[model samples]
Target: MNTKMFCYQCEQTVGCTGCTGNAGVCGKKADTARLQDELTGALIGLARAVDGAETISKRTSQVIMEGLFTTVTNVSFDDAAIETMIQKVRAEKERLVPDCSKCQSSCGKTDEYDMQQLWDANEDVRSLKSLILFGIRGMAAYAYHANVLNYEDAEVNRFFCEALFKIGYEESVETLLPVVLKVGEINLKCMALLDKANTETYGTPEPTAVTLTVEKGPFIVVTGHDLKDLQLLLEQTEGKGINIYTHGEMLPAHAYPFLKKFSHLKGNFGTAWQNQQKEFDHLPAPILYTTNCLMPPKSSYADRVFTTEVVAFPGAVHIDEKKDFTPVIEKALELGGYKEDQILTGINGGTKVTTGFGHAAILSHAGTVVEAVKAGAIRHFFLVAGCDGAKPGRNYYTEFVKQTPSDSIILTLACGKFRFNDLDLGEIGGLPRLMDMGQCNDAYGAIQVAVALADAFGCSVNELPLSFVLSWYEQKAVCILLTLLHLGIKNIRLGPSLPAFLSPNILNFLVKNYGIAPITTPEEDIKTLLNHNK
Candidate 1:
């Protein structure tokens, strides 16, 4: 049967095919996903119209990024929020192509393309467009993160339009391949901008160990991707007798010296982003989401879900652009956390996991790492990181990390590390076996480490003995994957599920050229990887 709705942009789609019925596995209604597609299509049209229009304004670029980011998994589950974004996109298009509206006969030039067309097109065409669309969606997340700090890169912003414009046009692999790589190239710039903004503003992250224990008294649990919101919360809740515990992506915030300096700022609360529904339920403190990966809050903690900076859930208290977190603070005091200290362990029953092994921290210890490698202490480096989700099969990550040879080093970032971050993997040459490289947006750190290692060995990054086993749940990961591909990095094993968006032809192309494969059982996949290395 022909598909009714085309919504397969995440790891958890209905039936593991695509969500074609009334709602997606993520609970995104058909209407909302369609609007998201429309918004995306309009952005593509705008990009096409403004192809070389002198210069693209920051406002235009911000709207494009925000529009794309809103469609990411678990971000805006509300259809009304998407409607508002669609309107915003239309308004932006109107501003860009005002003359098109006055044409006596309708000019298809500025009109949005129905997403179903791309979904139902020839496999090759659909695959190429999916790359363009998904690639931009990922880039938008990095761009959005960078934008929050008032740092912007012109090249990155310009490429957003360029990539989107290509999605709406007819193009081949030979012609579109460059645009695909350009997405990765621009995403690298975007990540660097965010890295600079975060390090400069929050101070370079150090090798810090964060405890899972929640201190007694009033505390606030903050999640999502925005460090700015977490910093604002830290500032406002200071000296108020309320403690702040980082949760989910915010765990990395504790690694920053500027953020960690606050006495009230406590340690991390949960493992990864997917466990929020279970973890946040009946929690004594208010949970604040500054960005995406917000699960539909359960009634038990629904009232306690506070949002800020574009993260919105109906009926949740939203901190506005002014960034006043008074509501969240009030909720924290009202909730009045545990009377005594509560010890919380990770998935592995460990009480603490260390983070802050960002590019700077790792590169500073490069000499030690290289020496360890040369001395036969570190045999392989496995980058086992990506988005974490509720999928049952995602345990592959935990098992994969568990089964890696003792001689290997594990580098992880993003929410995915929650799966095995707590396991006591022991240390190699004074460095922890599992190094947390900050948040998902901090994929930049992993890239930085890979490049530094390659430089030390005087080899190309692909020549280094490193393997990336990624598990993606959202669009931010999409951009990072593309960046790796753009750098010509090969033999990546991606799972728990392939994105529903990629057509068979595109999948074949990636497999043939990039050696990308969906993960199998941990035991089997490990054997395959070890053999490949041999």
Candidate 2:
């Protein structure tokens, strides 16, 4: 079939290749995809303008981060919104180099890049640049969240423009490869920035059990990964006879001290982001999307959707920067939730799930954990984390976690944990066998825990008895994977499948150097991972 668009940035691309028809696998229309490409191209133009400028201001960095974030999969499907973003990006470039557009000579150095060039480039070059582009796109989400909390990192901000500039400028493998890997190195810092922002703003997360029940009352289900939006919604709905529940990646908000203190901040609603369509069909409460993991809303509940920040969809009431959630609050009161308290079970049939094993929480139990490992009570550690998707093979994660030895512990984050998070994995030496380390960005906490464990064991992280069996769906996973590779951690088993954008040569390089491979059967993978040494 002749293709109207080309996208393979997510795990569930059409037929494990590219989505090339009227709409992408995530339901992004071709026109919307084109606009996203244009937005991305315009972001590169803004970065180009920053090149000859005196200094990078906070506003310039914010524009770049917001632009790149808007283009991430399932973030913004509204073409009007994307066009507006493109205009904003162009305006920023104009502010940066005012005379470039007016100059008679017209060097075109500050002109917006044609993204089709990167898409149609040589296969290897395309793959490398895709790594840098998509990796930074993921990093932008983290940086944006931090910026909202009034926490900004200059190096992380500077790298955003640098990566975008390289995506449009550098081509050779030798020249691009270092920049590609640098994305991971910088993302580590970005994730850390977000980590500090979240913990300091909300207080360290503590282990808390969140119910899967939607109580009988007016309520709002906040999805995506924005805590600030959720906080605002909670404050506005306080004592207004409304309850708030989290959905998808926002499930971890229940663990934070500040959020948990809200009496109305009740439980979690649905499972992962992929299940939103069925789970939300005629859902009585409105869902507020603060960031990505947004599938196009089905007509049944489309009217009940509210979006804020970079997340946008046509017809959904968007809560702007003012953060007034009155519309969402009124809608919830109108819907009136369920007639009775409805108990919802996770994919594994458990009625409640626990989260908030952040690095601080986990480290507080460091003595117990170290003793458990030294005493042979803990055999291994498996981090079965990453984004969840609608793909079929994702059941592998559920089974992998289920089949883990009773003596082992599972460290998970992101929505992927919804698979087996409800299952009773029991505990080892006073620590629950399964630990939810907050959201996907909480991978920072997991890294910290690993590093601390390695230090306690007098070994490197690779020598510790820990493994990363990850499931990835979107660009955020791309950046996190690159971060793992950047840390030189080896033998990472990634699935439901490898990224479609990974060319054969790049895949080979990752496999040979970092021991990355697609996941196989639960039994085989578990045995191999258990017996294998790095």
Candidate 3:
């Protein structure tokens, strides 16, 4: 088949393999996907060239991060933005290796790989490289968020180049497996750096319950992965008769003391990342995207979309580096919100959801959790965490949570929790059955809890009766998944579908080596899991 530009890197893509003929399930045109692939290819080339350079500048790192991140699912739905990123990558390459233009012979080392070649490579080779590429793309989003807060880790930045360089090289499962785990190890540090930046800058998150209702009058909805941008928005819009509500991963921002201190910083407004198109369609408030998970806007709310940091949408107002959010605030006031307090509920009709069960909160109750487990009150632990989307099969997560044995503990994080977060799962041993461990980046906290439990039990993490049933949608999930793989944690069940970018050989390798399985029916999977534990 002569593939066109469309791709199915996400869980929900047209026809499962990829959207080559026309538009994607997310409504991205074929041409846009092609441009994004071009940008990614250029980024891979740049990283390969800069891998061991003596003097790679901060600018090189920043562009590499931005270029990879922009290709993440639903981040840049605009063709023009991808084109701009391609140009930026090209310019960076020109600056780094200016002699490329004058050289008589071409050195394939610094040249961009046609993405089609990757797509057509041996299935196993393509899958391994895809793992490195996609994993870093997701990690870059987190790195970008942390970078904006002025927190950067040298190792994290360097591993990004290492990972990218590997993507361009020919390698096998033996060579790639170590690099795969390396992605996870590096992602763990990257996540910790972000955790430190977030907790230190904003106080350690305390347990918080937020409502879904929007109070009367003007309000602004802030979405994406960046907290600093939301904090800045909250600051600039404070006391201006404007309310700030969270959307997507920003839902956890409500639990941060520094953010919650703002009186007008209101509650969350929607479900997971995938519902934005419908939810924001007629929304009166302006939405400011500080990071990823941005969908192309509907014409009705297009003018009201505002972006800051690297989250640019075509034609929407951008706040730029200065972070002056006057335009976003103005849009909110202009929209003027509801005439009365609008009462809304989650998928379960619950008016509120509680969050902020980061490592601090979970560890504070560690003694209790340990006692409960020792007493046989809590039998097993399930970490059902990752990004959520609109795919029909994603109901598997909600079903999986519901099907967990009563003696088990469920620790969830990220936008995926929205699927069943509103349900009153009640408590086990004085701890809520479902603990929202902050955003996707806060997987660091979940890992901390696992390690602490392992230490208490005097065993390795995999020996602590812990199971990771993960759902992935974008790049951040990729990084976290890599982290889990790096930890040598086996018997993971991933769903609702495998990445279309992964070749059959790569999938088989993961299955044979890591015991990674696709999600089956909840009953079947639960039975299989219980048998394994037994």
Best by lDDT: 2
TM-score of each: 0.95, 0.98, 0.96
lDDT per residue, candidate 2, 80-113, as tens digits? Answer: 9999999999888898788676777746568788
Ranking by TM-score: 2, 3, 1
Candidate of highest TM-score: 2
lDDT of 3: 0.85
Winner of 1 and 3 under lDDT? 3
What total of clashing residue pairs does each candidate reach? 0, 0, 3
Candidate achieving higher lDDT, 2 or 3: 2
After superposition, candidate 3 runs with Cα above 4 Å error: 1-3, 171-173
Clashing pairs in 2: none
| Model 1: per-residue Cα lDDT over 1-534, one tens digit each | 233567777878876677888777776667767767777777777777678766789989888889888877777766667778878877787887786756687455676766767887777777777777887887787788878889998888888887777777765677777787777888888889999999999999998888899988899988887888888888898889999898888888888988988988889998787788898889999998888878778999999998876566778877778988888888888989998999999998999988999999999999999999889898889999998888789889999999999888999999899989889888898888889998988998899899889989998877777888999987778888989998889999999888776777778888999999999888887777766655
lDDT per prediction? Answer: 0.83, 0.91, 0.85
In terms of lDDT, the poorest run of 10 residues in model 2 is 100-109
